[model samples]
Target: MGEVNRRRFLERMTALTATAVATPATLGAIANAGSRFPGETRAGSRAAAGRPDELKLPPAGRPQPAELTELTLAEAARLLRDGDVGAVELVEAYLARIGRWDARYQAFNTVVSRDALEAARTADRTRGRAPLTGVPLAIKDNYFTAGVRTTANSFIFEDFVPDFDATSWARLRDAGAILLGKTQMGPLATTAASTPTGERTTANAWAPHHDDVSPGGSSSGSATAVAARMAASSTGTQTGGSITNPSNAQGLTGIKPTMGRVSLHGILPLTYTRDHPGPLARDAVDAALMLQIMAGPDPADPRSLGLPPVPDYLGAVREDAGALTHPERGGAVRIGVLPGFLDEPEPPEDPAPDPDPDIDRIGSSFPRRERTQAAYRREVATVEARRRMLATLEEMGAEIVALDFPTHWEALTSFNFNNVRLPERSEIFLEHLRDDVRKFGVSLAPWINGLLLPAAEYVRGSRARLVLLREVLDEVFARCDLVTQTAPFPFDMVGLPLIGFPIGFETGSTGYPRPIGGMFGAEPYAEHHLLAVIAAYQRATDWHLRRPADPGELRPAEGNGGGPRGGAGGSAGRDRSPGRYDLFDVMERGE
Candidate 1:
């Protein structure tokens, strides 16, 4: 798309998402429709809660030209610390890249060019206290940035700027990380929506003609930016599958730290118990680098359980891929697998398979035109990815064991218990908006206007959630180190640490190949174990590094402004770099 089209696309997205149902007639009618449900007290709950279009801040201060966009966050840090690259140079590389490419991808919300460059300049003067200090990163709109407008991708607070930073963000900011911009996201973190505005026609990073797919949200832009290499790393928040889904779709590793592992203060609320603020990065190590800074105590947030002793996540996820050598990968901790899951699809085994998207959801085209053998192949390919992962684990000497599927998965999946908490959320919104509640995002009106629920239902759902969190975990972890699953939402429901990583890619109608990811869940607070397994698998695989072929290989759009994809004239295609993908193959042959 050309510059004008790009500009229009962004403008339209902002207008649509900011389209609030704040008409006086609508507000008055919704207000009068009060308490529709048995226990919901919209006014009483005056409490609750709260991306797709990425808006770029106007360009400002000069950037230092440096050929350093694709370096892993760790590699970039090493260069920064060794004085091989100045912070300003690295910052310019990213800003220059974002300027050229983001229009094609629409992955960011607000690009803080002026502030980011200034921060980079400052980092250049100071000695680093952390590895993440000199990196450029993006934050989802849900996290507050003092003085920056954090709309949460809603019309409600589109004009609302915060005077404080969310704890997770504060830590990163203090660490010397530069904020490239906020990412585009779903309205109120609700769905997987597109970019904030422009680049509507950019082909899938995998295929050009076929671009129809959920970029995945509510962390859509964060994933896209990182995958597209717009930023070194970005922040993603997950109340349900936000972090993992986007990570899976974009071929990135997203770690949803255990609840309370990271602080929540100064951020919008989704569910009191389920909200998770974490990092999305190109690899597990980059993710670990970010988590090291985010996973600690916050005096501001009571929920920030203050990690008693911070673990060296970076040390755990290393290039050495040594986690596979740990005896726990074999004898000490059992690899949890549901009986017969790997064997065949027989009905009797009764399993709580992790969160895999519905097959219909994975299908690419619209309408029941036809189901060719090609479609069937795509489905089979996804399943095969899972089997390959199982085989790899066995090769590494891990002991796979059968465990009864947890009962909670059924209810947790079928009926999101978090639904009962809706009234509370709406209440919080109204409270936050106060007189301006009507002035808030009007799109929310359809969901909350006159909405109420039976207090008893809310209570029952909360109670059921408690029971599931307590009882199911006690049983599952007693028998295994972590459970294998599709999406890991069951774990999210009860506030457990869960992760999802790409195993391979699957071809579909959208011309672009879809990512095939496997999900894993650890007992609560066992993120280290989760990270270890991810690090090992990634060290042995190349799928995560594979970038799509047609759409993005450093070529700027036909008639756009940005110079090239990486500025250094580099192609992101991992397939071209034989050594990278061959790492695991070489190891396999030697063994």
Candidate 2:
């Protein structure tokens, strides 16, 4: 066969078996969803009435809301446990901030102020040492929150309120974390936060004034909520880089734990094997704590069963990776770098112009040209930043190794997505597709395309996936403990764990600084490895510590404060009456 035909033949073969392996898992999940998983009865009870953890109390003193809001999750937990800050006060502080700024950012689709405050009150009154006691979190809209409107930011689910909490949220609530609200998301978690008509809803916290900037898709509002300090940290789910992309865009730390590390029982599923529910936090340590609480086996998700016990994430993060030797690697954390990922080749001189028909379609592609140039510059800067970060990691005793995967990265990722991911997503949403495809909005075409895929190709793709997974395990992972690259598809395809964190920043054309992010992928069930390395990097660098400028920093002209209320423990305003806490009313009043 000719070279092209040979390649085509292989592609055909690979696509045929894409869905064969995943069918059993999907059916098992559906079967088990109705029954309570082990300890689920206990989880359900805890979810109904949250229990707070007890710790040694320090002398009490009232801390300003702004000061309380500024502290990290770990810091805030210490304050809550030490009795220095009341849970009510902490929740009130975040609620006030959200009420003040969220109107402009549109980070939340629903802010459960009354519910959150009540939960906070419970946290204050109750006692025990669970990790997240009294911590406030912005949950992604896709996650089911019993009685709360769980719209997945879609018109189809606009009025839908789930009767049961998602397993991830239930775990957090049971551990004493207060639900701040449901952050806005891409309609059905398929694109950036936008209406069915494609009108943007959420704004990038770093550049809210610029309509051109993206907060990143699907998990956009989750990242915005954290970046704007509207909530301490937030939950995010990734089917295809949803968690990491937004976290990178907003300069936060996001971990897409191994697919089954956390159960996806109540999350709106995009793909059975690729959907990973995890945390977008201020830093790696915060991410670790949240993941620790979120990770565990659940009978509702058969994929989560048969896994080893969740590791000591906090302990792993606390260990100085720089100082301690990795037993297996025989050195510090072995980070594998793909030179192509970090080094961008120069654009070809005298590039071919757009075809004549293209020019006729759009008179001037200046907008396209401008976008391309800006992206090129951003990537250039990102390359530089990543190279610098590698140097820094080496200085901190990490061993950087150049490595390459066995399969063609681009080819394999495209095959996996088109053949495997699309089919699974289509299967999950087949009822919607058959009924009213128009409701899918920006994702309608993609959903339709999935329906058009040949069954033989999908089965072939599944067979190829098994081959790729074995190759990755035997070849790629054998060389390094972690791969230092941000493209999540390759790892997400194989169900491996990865972490995305801020490495540096570059000022955009709008003069607003945007963050540049780096990621490291680890072997399956090895989230602790990913977390430890990132925590060490965070400890050494302050990129993750940077906060976005609040668009609503200055209150209305009639308001008392002229500057940001977030600084120096200053009061933004006193808490309003319980009746006045409704976000819709607050936004309508234009306050």
Point out where model 1 deviates above 4 Å. 1-67, 194-211, 306-308, 319-322, 325-332, 339-376, 416-418, 431-446, 549-591
Candidate 2, 1-591: lDDT as tens digits? 000111232234332123211121121121122222223222212122211222212344444556567656765665575566778999999998888877667889999999998888888887424556788999999999999999887777889999999998998877778999998887777767766555667777776644456778778899999888888889999876788888888898999999788999999887787889999998887787688778888889999888777765655565433323563456677888765876674653344344343332111111122224456678788999998888888888888888875665556665334346677778888998889978776556556656777899877777767777787778778888888765666777777888989999897554557899888888888887888788777767878867765564322212211122122122333222111111111111100
Displacement of residue 462 (Cα, Å) in model 1 is 1.6
Q: Clashes per prediction?
A: 34, 21
Rate residue 299 of model 1 by lDDT. 73
How high is the lDDT of residue 526 in model 2? Answer: 84
Any idea what lDDT model 1 has? 0.61
Instruction: Kindly list the per-residue Cα lDDT of model 1 for residues 1-591, writing each as its tens digit.
Output: 100111233244343223321121221222122222111122221111101011121221221253256556765664465455778888888888778666556677789999998988888887554545678998988899998889776666577799998888887776667888888766566555322221222222333222344566678788888876678889888875888878877778898988888888887876577788889887776777677678776677666644445544544554443565542445534678864445433232223233333433212221131234444555577678878987787777666777876766566544335455456566666665465554433234323521466678767877787778766667677777867865445667678887878887875544345677777888766776777677777767776666543244333333221112222234332221111111111111100
> Against the true structure, whose TM-score is highest?
2
